[model samples]
Target: MARASSPKRKPSRRPWRRRLILALKILGVIAALGVIALAVTVYTTRAQLPSFDQLKSSPNGQMIRVHAADGTVIVSLGPSYGEWLSYDEIPKVMRDATVSVEDRRFRSHIGIDPIGVLRSVKLMIANWGTDRRIQGASTITQQVARTIFLSNKYTLSRKAHEAILALALERKFSKDQILELYMNKVYYGGGAYGIDAASRKFFGHSAKQLSLGEAAVIAGLVKAPSHYSPTADAEAAIGRAGVVLQLMAETGAITPEQAADTDPKSVALAPEPHQNSVRYFTDWALPQLDMLIDETNAPLDVWTTLDLSMQRAADTAIKADVPKGVQGALVSIDRDGAVRAMVGGKDYVSSIYNRATTAVRQPGSSWKLFVYLAALEAGYKPDDMVVDEPVTIQGWSPRNDSGHFSGAMKIRTALAYSVNTIAAKLGQDVGFHTVADMARRFGITTPIDTTPAMVLGTSEVHLIDMTRAFASVANKGIAVTPYGITKVTANGVTIYQHEVDRSHVLVAPYVAAEMTDLLQTAVATGTGRAAQIGRPVAGKTGTTTSNKDGWFLGFSSGLTTGVWMGRDDAKRVGGLSGGHAPARAWHDYMIKAVAGRPVEQFDTQVTLPEWQLEPDEESYFGQPDNGMFVDENGYPIAPGTYPGDTPTGPPPQQGYPDAYPGGTYPPDGSRTAPPEQPPVQQPPERLDQDWMDRVLGRTPDPDRRAAPAPARTPPPNDRSRGP
Candidate 1:
């Protein structure tokens, strides 16, 4: 009874409560509407994001370029801008070919044909998840949108986006605009960007120039670029092209007879040459471009100073003459120090070791030019007399090549013959420190020893540096820094250009001229004879100790070339000499390089003095006495000695053996016996000094000069004499 009474009373207690309940019902409805609104906003936000087209045409897009040293164009950057036509401009056979090959439902779709979709769905379901062959139901418009505006992510969300974009694209543009955009944007391999680019790149013609068969082949690439690329597999591409033609006939796009009549020429695709003729020049130029621009996206066309023909000639020559398994490098530069041609190694693909600019090996006698130049700078003449005999300095004795004394010879002869002893003596005389400094001034970056041995090229140097040094001589002693890139243009604007700076290192042109003459002699008659061209040529041959390295550096009127051959490990190769291998390569390359060019000679007019040989001591001493003279005490004595024979006078020097006995001399000056006493040892008078100054120039500092006195011999009765 109490519960029933309380329920009635509670209901009657509140009118405001009823109003609150009504308000709660209205608020619940508003909350539901708000949830729906938020979901719609999130979906719309993602669907409207900018697509690939918008990003591609943006300001920060990547740039491309194709250029050569000479302004020849192989291809270009950006989309091909010709007015693109389809269905109508395209031959009916081509249109049908494309449709039959790419999409059979092209005409029946409103953006996408539902019938194709259902068919694809049924096939997929029947095969379960293992069937990728259930062809995509995307119509041509949808395909264009997927290729250009969306990625290949196969998900419902991506598909929905592609569908929406495709529908929007159809509304915004015509069917022709969509097809044109698709055809002009797809990749066709072989460095081609689009169908037009591909047509030209593969068949060497324009898109409009494609035959029915050729068009079919190009159309087949849309499904898979690599599989149908002519360069990748010619037979597969041809077969696929046949299928397209057959499909065209089946689809009523072409008559069977017409399809049979269209026979395209078999595509003859050539492998693209990996390197340009100016490979080294480009290698040198690319680094400079990196410094000047944001290389990753720089829109620059670089024009180099490389002469392509010369470069090709050089490459061909090296390939023809360089022996197998022997790596070599060749560098040729113009008088202005512009690199004309360079072969970094025997084969760049096999070995990227750019020996031309990278390998640093001993220059051998090639370095002697610096020493001779230093001597010339220090007031030494080319004809200055120096003894080509055994020399000892700091307990190190240097011997000639054959270990035979040549007595005194002119400096020119020493340099031409590359006599190690004479060069060492001259280097010691000229101050090794001066020679080292000269080497640096001549563009040698490798550290050179201040020892006399440096005169014989004991220092290491790169081929490039050696070439530049020889180029300097050809440039009349003006040092030219070698360069490759001439100019770089971007977007019709020159972004960079190279300007060579020529700094004069040698004050006297006559000195360079003299050195050039000596080097010329080396090429003509001495070690570098293999490098002799039909015309005047100046060069030096370098052979390292034990044949560890070989080098031939020479210059024509317009170009200077340096070639080096050696093992990468610095090991000696038996029977290899600079004059034989490297010189031959140099000669072959030069002959081809200068074939049609006019012969130009070095313009050095400085007269070299006549070479003179000093008299051997045997010519001064008479024949040894065999009882020819008697002492006051009736003792037999040598003809040239006094009767006492007490060894009190100056000890007798070892003279050439007398041909005749009893001091009897041959009537002719050619007699084998000792002829006459050479002038007695006396202080050099004015005439002697004049002769010395004329022939040997002023003697270098005594510390730098070879010892003036000849080696002493043991007295006849001395116990120290060797048997």
Candidate 2:
């Protein structure tokens, strides 16, 4: 009966209606709380942020650019800027492409695009449920705010800061000004920070000169620079540009026909200097800046010792010669140890490991330089007789690069031929301790074991260090600590200047001359003939066992260069030897490097005793019956004939009769004769201790010497067996 009565009354609807109204009130309160929270976040973020003017004129955004000796920009560190372009100067295609790809709703947004945020939320939900991808919804203004004012960290506070700054920027600047700032502050890869620099770096032109396709390619790089770098991976960059083109068409920025007509592949990238190989030098030099001055945000002008022309030459030579699966590195330094040119690897884009400065590989026969130097210091003259027969030291037997060894030969001849047994004997006689000391004195900072095999270059060494050692010899026995930065300037004010610092002489001048004599013979007719450059050249050739490493260390015309070729994984390269590839590369590089410079001569050639063969020894060594004897000066003379006596035979014939050239003999046997005496050319003006400062356009300051950064040491197991 009560139920019937209630049904008749139809249960007044007020209670349920009241419940609905209360629920609505609660929902409204929650929405109001959200709004208050967002307002507080914005206020707090704005309170901590830099003012718009501060962000616009920040010095922290400045870059460090390294210039070569001729004032050519070789590499840039930090953010690189080009001339700021006005809004009108930016190509319309570039603006449209960037907007289409970066933020389709950029024009309609008021600092933050609500519709875009909602769409992004929807897509994110869809992605979570259906495993689909979602694009980011950060508007261009938000990006500008983030880049200029906030860190890239993905925190709620950072997001709040980005939004607050973006809103503030919109209120303070017109839309065109905002866009101009965005374009001028955004980063495009390869060290480029602005649209103008990006255009110049990738397309070799100005932003105002971009075509539709080129603009699209550059716009696409904003998402990922290394992945889509045109100079790094052209195919990937072109594909990314195609996607940008499709987006342009979809956004009505370009017609479908126009997008289809533009081929991304048609975009030609700028030709980089030495394929940007100078990055190795910059990477090595940038770290030293911390030691020179206090940490600074202002832009720095780093005048380096690099020669752009020589760098190009080294890069070209390495690219034209290094075989596949093999990597090559070269380091060239002036007599004062200023690094002029450096090629770390065959292609820097493929590998960034700096072989010239960091990699430590075996010097093979080149290591013998220290051993022979030790012997020279131990009162052994170049003309002293040294037997090349089989010898053993400490149960380690060393073999000649050539299977056969001559019974007896002059010490210079033994070194020129790179006879391993003779080097081992010399190391034993002079003491490996002395050999190691000699190496250390010549800028070889790497640890050396006193083992017998160390004399044959079994110990590892860096190309830069070996080049520095040879540079000391070329500098007439003065020690050389290789340096790159000549001067550093910040905000147009001088901060640091490199001091001419060669305070120690590693060896006596006479000893260096004697070593130079042996090295000259090696290049003139022995193992290193392939390195000859029609001028007095001195160097040593090195080939590791199984052809795992090949090296050539030499100097000519006041430039000392060292070259190394090997696999990074220590795998063997077939048919690779120092005399063949490394020597040839050294020759090619030196020929171009010394061009137009006065063909300088080494110090007065040291005279050595002549080799007088026994009556039966010439035939015993398989010499021809009419064979000629080589006088003390390396000129061929009739048997039993002395110097200054006319030979009763055909004009000085080619080829050595008894002692053969070291390492691999030329297949053609054309290098049998000594290097032709080059017409003497005037030498460059003699340089004093302050010569480097003069060349670098700074006054000498002997009192202020900045200690160079410590040399990197390789692991103890980095040794390679010598041939």
Best by TM-score: 2
lDDT of 2 by residue, 560-674 (tens): 9999998999765654667767777888898999886786766755232222221121111211111122222222334435332222222223233322332233332222333
Model 2 RMSD in angstroms = 16.3
CA lDDT, every prediction? 0.64, 0.74
- State each candidate's clash count: 0, 0
Q: Between which residue pairs do clashes occur in model 1? A: none
Off by over 4 Å in 1: 1-69, 73-277, 293-298, 605-723
lDDT of 2 at 156: 69
